[model samples]
Target: MAWYATPGGLSSLSAPQLAAARRSYDLWSSGNPGLASKYSFDSYVEYAQQRHAESVAETAEQEED
Candidate 1:
């Protein structure tokens, strides 16, 4: 588990997780008004989690090859 320092306090999310969520927001937040309105931090966090899993799987595959 990784911890990050926030303005309020420490967050359970790692630096990479936070970075991924921010990138996810930047990609999706401004495109569709409807989607943007419905999207939230929780959604971004989910995306980040999926993205991390995919990345890990990809790396494992590459190592196997």
Candidate 2:
């Protein structure tokens, strides 16, 4: 299953929360507007949280299986 489809992954984020996260990422990226550099601090943090949540959900599913 996709990361977003995983248990606890989709439910972990509400519609408003997802919109806010997207807005934050967009704002951060737009501020720099350089391809040479990577994501900003806020973007990195958001990505890390998303990755961590997905990983945790995947691990839980694996353990269940």
Candidate 3:
């Protein structure tokens, strides 16, 4: 029912979606620090890193099971 619940949606993401998202955000910020400053850079980076770590952990747990 939910978009993300769909098989296609789940399959659309690569194995390392969080890494990809982090890289994209980093690139954007590097190119436009002023625009990035419009956001809370420290909080954004912290959240991104936390989410990436969680994703990696979850993937590892899934593989173990």
Q: Against the true structure, whose lDDT is highest?
A: 1
What order do candidates take by TM-score, descending?
Answer: 1, 2, 3
**What residue runs in model 1 are displaced by over 4 Å at the alpha carbon?**
1-11, 14-27
Off by over 4 Å in 2: 1-36
Clashes of each: 0, 0, 0
- The digit string of per-residue lDDT tens for model 1 on 1-65 reads 32112221214566675776567576777776687788786665565556666777899999999
Answer with 1 or 2, whichever has the higher lDDT.
1
lDDT-wise, the better of 2 and 3 is 2
What is the TM-score of candidate 3?
0.43
Estimate, for each residue in 1-65, the C-alpha lDDT of model 2 and write its tens digit: 33233234334666765666566566766776783166654444456577877888899999999
Q: Estimate, for each residue in 1-65, the C-alpha lDDT of model 3 and write its tens digit.
A: 22222233224445575455457668978998997888554455555555666777899999999
- RMSD list, candidates in order: 6.4, 8.0, 11.0
Q: Where does the lowest 10-residue lDDT sum fall in candidate 2?
A: 1-10
Please estimate how well model 3 matches the true structure, expressed as its whole-model Cα lDDT.
Answer: 0.57
Whole-model Cα lDDT of every candidate shown, in order: 0.59, 0.58, 0.57
Clashing pairs in 3: none
Alpha-carbon deviation at 47 in model 3, angstroms: 0.2
Lowest summed lDDT window (length 10), candidate 3: 1-10
In model 1, how large is the Cα lDDT of residue 64? 100
